[model samples]
Target: MELCFFDQVKAQPLWVQILLVVGTISILKFSFAVLNWVYVTFLRPGKNLKKYGSWALVTGPTDGIGKSFAFQLARKGLNLVLVGRNPDKLKEVSDGIQAKFGKVQIKSVVVDFSGDLTEGIRKIEEAIEGLDIGVLINNVGISYPYARFFHEVDEQLLKNLIQINVEGTTKVTQAVLPGMVKRKKGAIVNIGSGAAIVIPSDPLYAVYAATKAYIDQFSRCLYVEYKKSGIDVQCQVPLYVATKMASIKRSSFLVPSTDGYARAAMRWIGYEPRCTPYWPHSLLWALVHMLPEYAVDAWRLQFCLAVRKKGQLKDSRKKE
Candidate 1:
């Protein structure tokens, strides 16, 4: 009888093998990362949403989910003011929102988010010119060319992401928060992604995830400190909402419509505190959470292989 060395008892234990499978699937399947994130962060229930701000200001209102947020709020009878870098797109979404919500007073304010965040915010200060601003939705965000990795990124793009992710958000929040506090009635909802909580090892979008990490931590702290004064601070961690940010994948289980995320966002209007948009994704998220760090790292390598540079000249992957 010949003994086969390969068929001998598996070197790794059963639990370790299970973990390996989870990690492998996580990297190969974006849904794993998305699901894990939905579990860890989205499990928290929200607050009472009936009392929405009468005058709502939503940044990044020109593209992706931000535009949807402005429209949905308008539909809910809240007077909306759309804010973004592009004046044309701003006007476009503004026109459509006004046409549909006809009665809702919708306004547009344009400012470059990637520029000096503080200076751009000053322009917004001028837009309102101090008229008791009510709701502050800090929705501006960007993920530079998908091809660029962390060290490969240029100084300009790095600065751009930081400005929008950290500085722009902080400045706008600072600008509007005092009034919301003074009035003792307001809500501040920061748009964040599942990337913030999961913090994947994928080098493809290292900085982008870091920026969102700041948002998750930042909003949670704000909620704890300020809810007493009637200010609601919440973070909506959605899976990849198909928007301009959808450069990577368009129709994965991980990627849903901006309209879906927008509706899910309204569910948190009063807020249970911090909840994910889609509820059923919790199961996928839970399984991913139990994974060990080493396994997650190896799994991410598979993700890198899946998106390597095809270098197609005919049509760049980026969408205008």
Candidate 2:
């Protein structure tokens, strides 16, 4: 049989033989990748979060992805430490969850990530003092109000972006890390952005992208540092979820609603150190990477310029 196959290949034209060999290898490689994606995305079982601990702490829990995560965690019977800047909003979210999951315990902490982060994180540490907080969702982050050139960014906005997105995440993780370290088992999920990962460049939202890039690297480092300690650290990169920050009010196939994104996100915790949770976003990420970086960069710049024009128009209308 081997001699017959060799004879058949020898009989074929040189180019045809080369094409067949390459085509078979390519098909097998592509098939394996597709199967792996399917298993990871759909077939793989999610970790039983309860095993991590009984309580989960989430930041920015008053709205958007944070809010959805809070509700979902409650649904899973995990007690909560809901942290947000506004006390009233925190109370409201806490009350809503308590109402639905009457048996679940809930605690609220007021933390303004932009103002006096030391105090903010102190509040978190204090609130979680006795709780077995197995999960820490560093979901609090800020983005540009709208797109603008790097030079067009104001001092206040720039300060807030760095303070809230970068420093805030770092401090909160520091406050929570010791407890998890002592317990020696926990999951930490830092919310990241496609601006830093999926796209070649986020032209007008430069600082926001940079901050998220820091988060990606930061999470990777912690993952390696803590894996042996039974702590799972991850950075979740999501693209264009329909949220107020994105200025996208309506959810669509590509733009998942906050709840949808959180649902997908929950499945990925304690797994990959870096991941795009929403499957559609993963598809988008893959497509973006296939294109030339230069082309993507140019397209991003033009898109941001248009966004800036529209934002400026809205500002003028408000003033008028």
Candidate 3:
């Protein structure tokens, strides 16, 4: 008697049956991933900021992504505590936020991340005293003046990068976390870089990437530790934005303006341990990961070399 197709399939080797089952599961998993991506990218509702807290503190709020975060958070009806190295810039941002958002309260704190962090953190702690700060944007960070080999990095730049990026973030988070723990509701958003996450390796920006990688881990650990405490910790990784730090003077579809990036970033807060907020940047990240490791390394090397060349020229012109 001839076996029917279903009987034949059942009678196949156990390994073959296992392979079929695994293949079906893998396909389903991929489909679900796509659907989830679509939902998050376009359809998911953002959490209400007021649910987290009445006030938000933003570091490095004088310019770039930090400044945009301050403005966006103010628009969301949350009061602002603006922290930056420049007192004048901080005051200006505070005044601007107050001017536009009439009912929103604003405070400015000037603390240079690269200076005496103990003193700066004390100032921050004092400034937020008695205030219910529900959101903390650990956005203060520094990068290379321009891409250069690790061996070529200047001593001052090296120290500043570590101090400002790693130490500053850690200390500021420490300052705000106790209050969040007490209230059992808060959000911490650490600004990270795609150089650390997307690329196979960031060739010349070694120190910068390492510091951001630390932030990614730091945020993840805190996320797990604080989940039960009603606190959310997230690291937002962005490839590039049209900001002075990135040396990108113009915004494009891929590289959004600071305001554009911040607007999307605010929507993602209190959601994921790690996220690439801009949809286009997320697509770029996916594409980068699809390429071969060697190809990615080669591309990164070329890109960093170009950055180094431009930086050297700019320095020479400045010296003249």
Q: Mind giving the per-residue lDDT tens digits that candidate 2 earns over 214-283?
A: 9999999999999999999999999999999999999999999999999999999999999999999999
User: After TM-score superposition, what is the CA distance of residue 90 in candidate 2 from its true location, in Å?
Assistant: 0.7
Q: What is the C-alpha RMSD of each candidate to the true structure, in Å?
A: 9.8, 2.0, 2.1
Across 234-277, the per-residue lDDT of candidate 1 in tens digits comes to 88777656676656446456666777767667766556456566
What lDDT does each candidate get? 0.73, 0.93, 0.93
In TM-score terms, candidate 1 sits at: 0.78
Backbone clash tally for model 3?
A: 0
Backbone N/Cα/C clashes per model:
11, 0, 0
Ranking by lDDT: 3, 2, 1
Instruction: Order the candidates by TM-score, highest first.
Output: 3, 2, 1
lDDT of 2 at 140: 92
Model 2: number of clashes? 0
Stretches of candidate 3 off by over 4 Å are: 1-5, 11-15
Report the Cα lDDT for residue 186, model 3: 97
- TM-score of model 2 relative to the true fold? 0.95
List model 3 lDDT by residue over 39-152, tens digit each: 987889889988888999999999999999999999999998888889888888888888999899988888988888999999999999998999999999999989999999
